[model samples]
Target: MDLTTRCLFLLSCLCMLLAIDLDAVEPSYYVDTSSTSDVIDYKDPCKAAAFLGDIALDEEDLRMFKVDRIVNVARQTVQTVNRTDPVTGSSTNEAGQSSVVPNRRGLRRWKRAATSRPERVWPEGVIPYVISGNFSGSQRAIFRQAMRHWEKHTCVTFIERTQEESYIVFTYRPCGCCSYVGRRGGGPQAISIGKNCDKFGIVVHELGHVIGFWHEHTRPDRDDHVSIIRDNIQQGQEYNFLKMEPGEVDSMGEVYDFDSIMHYARNTFSRGIFLDTILPRYDVNGVRPPIGQRTRLSKGDITQARKLYKCSRCGDSLQDSSGNFSSPGFPNGYSAYMHCIWRISVTPGEKIILNFTSMDLYRSHLCWYDHVEIRDGYWRKAPLKGRFCGDKVPEPIISTDSRLWIEFRSSSNWVGKGFSAVYEAICGGEVKRDNGQIQSPNYPDDYRPNKVCVWKITVAQGFHVGLTFQSFEIERHDSCAYDYLEVRDGNTENSPLLGRFCGYDKPDDIKTSSNQLWMKFVSDGSVNKAGFAANFFKEMDECSKPDNGRCEQRCVNTLGSYKCACDPGYELASDKRSCEAACGGFITKLNGSITSPGWPREYPPNKNCIWQLVAPTQYPHHPAVRRFRDRGQRCVQV
Candidate 1:
């Protein structure tokens, strides 16, 4: 036993005598492909740093940033990890909401609630939400996993209102996270999502300020790219760094995105560890992107949420900064029965290349006659990045999200020279997104020895493709046989089996009724771990396999029926199913707990139980004077 203890005793006797039976992977598990290293550039074109830095305005600094957005509207959660932003990839953990920005008012800015009152939107983008309190059962499966990250890339639609009059409550307070940047009418409104605001990018940045956006560094051209160091903030919160004012904001064109998941985290409200409130005006040769990356959204946040929820589309809608558009009167010939559409929008980690330079129209073979179609998102059911006519210059058509639609048909009799595409907005890796998160190779750490990865996740189309593993280390094997991780629901390679996961635990949710999900991550050139981090969102259609009466004791299906819930101390009874005793008559709230009744899971042959603890009777306790002693089985206390 030498040579590293005989390769650690032949990998612990080949992980307890092997196990790699995914319909027989034995061919000694091929597919090493030398490279499947899949990343497919899901466009995040980091050129971020778009001019806007150096601000400190007025209107009493916008009425002291709306009295500091109502003193950072609280409900209170307080996870408190501190170091709120020593910059260098900031650090925030207060989580119980307060969308973190108090480096002494570190300019969390994104103010828009007085555009003279009116711009609440969400009327058709549909957002009804609810949630209520005492949340648990893994916080309601983390509130449908932070609402499937805004139902996997916006077109909104949150549903579930019962007789709506103005919704969006999502409470579980001890407050802090905060919402209310938009639609703040009548009742329900709140948003809180307390205690570390339950991640998933702080519940999609407090539901993008309850679906109305604002805080992408408080726009108004964020001081030309970012550089707000007014003595590293904290001076009366310097009016939360005021700015916003050029028609206050519409940005549907997009650009100045320091990876905007709604930026604000340089050293947000700095004033410590050698202060530096928000720097980087340029200089990204070290390759950037990671300045508050709540993981998704940033294509200028789905291009200003598809221009603030007016998402119908056929043309006109672009952003950040770019120019040139043709096919309609471009140098000549282009009308007589036409159909033009141009949507360019960029900035959520950029992309949209297109550079046809010059062309003559009306071709054949595929263009069908008079064409120019490109789509990377929004309509034509996105994905076909090109469809040129009789052009010849069809190479650069980049965009994987951040919008690019572009369509220009014409055939009321030939239309030539009417083409010249030249669009810009790039960031690299050639990608096309449909919902993201894919890691394994060098993920979290350790992963890279004999590598081989493959990830194919498609979405949109009556959805269904869940996959959730947020983390899974490899190199172990009880049955995974050795460095496994095979998930395949369809997309070739004989698509079928949906499970294969390996050692280091973490592997349960694997859904795939179909919309594609084909992952593979083999590695065995000699052991290594830390490799796995799934997250494939979008799974709506299992309201308990079509029973959908809504809920009673247990029914959990969301995104329609507004995520019907109720199952933890039960309550939804109003003929909603059946479950009662909702604390108050001893349902004891303050965030759910207390079992023993039928818990640790069912018991008691003969029973009679009563429980009540409730907490805080004006806070007072401890006054033991005597003792108790029983002898049925000898119970004693003194």
Candidate 2:
């Protein structure tokens, strides 16, 4: 097979043996770390396996197990020795001998510790805690299975217990362990479980120690700690209690038992240094049955736990209180101490004014955050600032639906020191309601009305008129209810009044008399007055009559007026106001006839004659008329 194929085969085999699905591997697995020769020839599968195994193993077991387990076992048996204080380089064995020799490789495996400090003090009561972690579903299931085992064996409850006595909080940091602490004032004890621990049984085990249960593996009478076989064991890597430092040892000072739930699982052939002969088991009959894939807690575990720590009677409690308050006058019949955050909603291109009022002694400041949603599943934040004073504030005009949230924070150090003080928030706009509905005021209270009311009336020359009344409502009134209406002609201000009508009483009704000359009305005490439509037509009739010699024809009087006419020799024009002559030329058709004594026998025909200009002596100058037969030329006249 090609080298790559062989390597793939070997990796696939290893994965199957470990019960891991290769498809589930992360990208980090594909990294090439070996030299070119190693990659080409598959020179060292053990080294490749070691690297792959380290990645595959749980973080807790990475440093504890050898990668090439088979190869390491086949080598000439090397006696296992326990290393205590890997940092200080100390070692101990079953013989109780100790030596200091540096384990150079062991130092590389230590992890960094957490350094962040808690900012706020934990409330002095039962605080609820939750778990955060990196365990897969299967891994969590396995952990739970282990937990059941511990619970069955130990009386301690891992999930729920009295709050004052204990609370379990879990987290996911790798290579972590659980611990419990009693508070300084004996308020409560807390149990913290690490997320990295693979075996849930470890939780019950560690909690057991916190409550004072001694490890069964460390039972002094059993002396199983030194009696167990340790052959072909990988030193400083796995399954050796002798490797524990002084701190890892229990405070109770008991001997160790290999079968203890606390004991590490190790290879059967492992034997310890300084043992003259490898002991198969500490006690032949003392061997507990091997825990099945589904190991559970035993009755002995619970009995032993209850003997150490007793349950407490207290329950859980916590405290949270913050901020300030105020009581202020509210507009619109509302009043209360409101600890409020302002929210603004407006349409595009709309401007709104916000007003606030408060009577609190402290200076107040307003701060707000603008929350805008740009698109699906996205958001952005903007800051909003507003004016503020001890009693009032107004927000600047805004033009978007971009919602605003406002908070009023007080600056007086004295306020909200021990307990929060109440404050009221009031918001008002130019908008208002009348009755139950929104409306604009008919007349703005701020407006001033003009004093004079003028009316222009037009009437034909002849017609009787009655009462004229104006229609309007009074929105607001002064103490005296009086106003005047004036009437005027179409001409300039100097024009004469055709007639005048006046009365002290406010008329209920005003009408003209039958003669059409005067106005009349009933008088009541009230001044529900209206202006004149009185005998105005009568005045126009008298003014329109022909005056003096202006009319040369007959005078015909019409209702409220009159017209003029002329005689037969004078014809009246269409205007009926002027006269004109009807005769064309002078009197040329005169025959031997004389009508008036002023008639001429042969008149100058073209001469225009005036009515009073004709003379009696003009025609008879020769006494022809008196003496013999028209002595003037042809004495004919028509």
Q: What lDDT score is found at residue 281 in candidate 2?
A: 47
Runs with alpha carbons beyond 4 Å of true place in candidate 2 = 1-129, 136-155, 159-168, 176-215, 221-231, 237-240, 243-259, 266-294, 311-638
lDDT tens digits, residue span 1-638, model 2: 23211111121111111111222211111111131111222111122111111111112222333222211212321343454433333356556433222234433211011001121112221232222233333343344344334333332323312233333334332224533221112232223334445565665454443333333432323343344443444443332222322222322432233334443343322444433222324444676444211133444444333323321111101000111222222222112222332233221111223223333223333322211111110011334343333432333333222223343333333232111122221111221111011101111111112322122223333443333221212222242234322222332234333333333332232223221222111222333332222112222233244462256555543333344544433345555557543221122221222122122233222223221112233332111223223433532221
Model 1: per-residue Cα lDDT over 1-638, one tens digit each: 22211111111111111111222211111111111112111111111111111111222223222221122122122232334323322243343322222233324233322222344665665676555435543444455445545654555655445456777766644424555555654655556566766777777776776676656666677677777887777643544555555554445445777877667777766667567677657756576545657777777777567656646443454443467777767877877567766666543334567788888887787778688788776555667866887757777776764457787777758657777666765432322244555655434346667656566667777777777664567877678776897887976558998788887677877777777777777787888976665546666664555555444434554322223444433345455455543211232233333332233334223323332323345533231323222223521121
Worst 10-residue lDDT window, candidate 2: 433-442
As a whole number from 0 to 100, the lDDT of residue 418 in candidate 2 is: 15
lDDT of 2 at 611: 18
Superposition error at 621 for model 2 (Å): 99
Residue 393's lDDT within candidate 1 is: 77
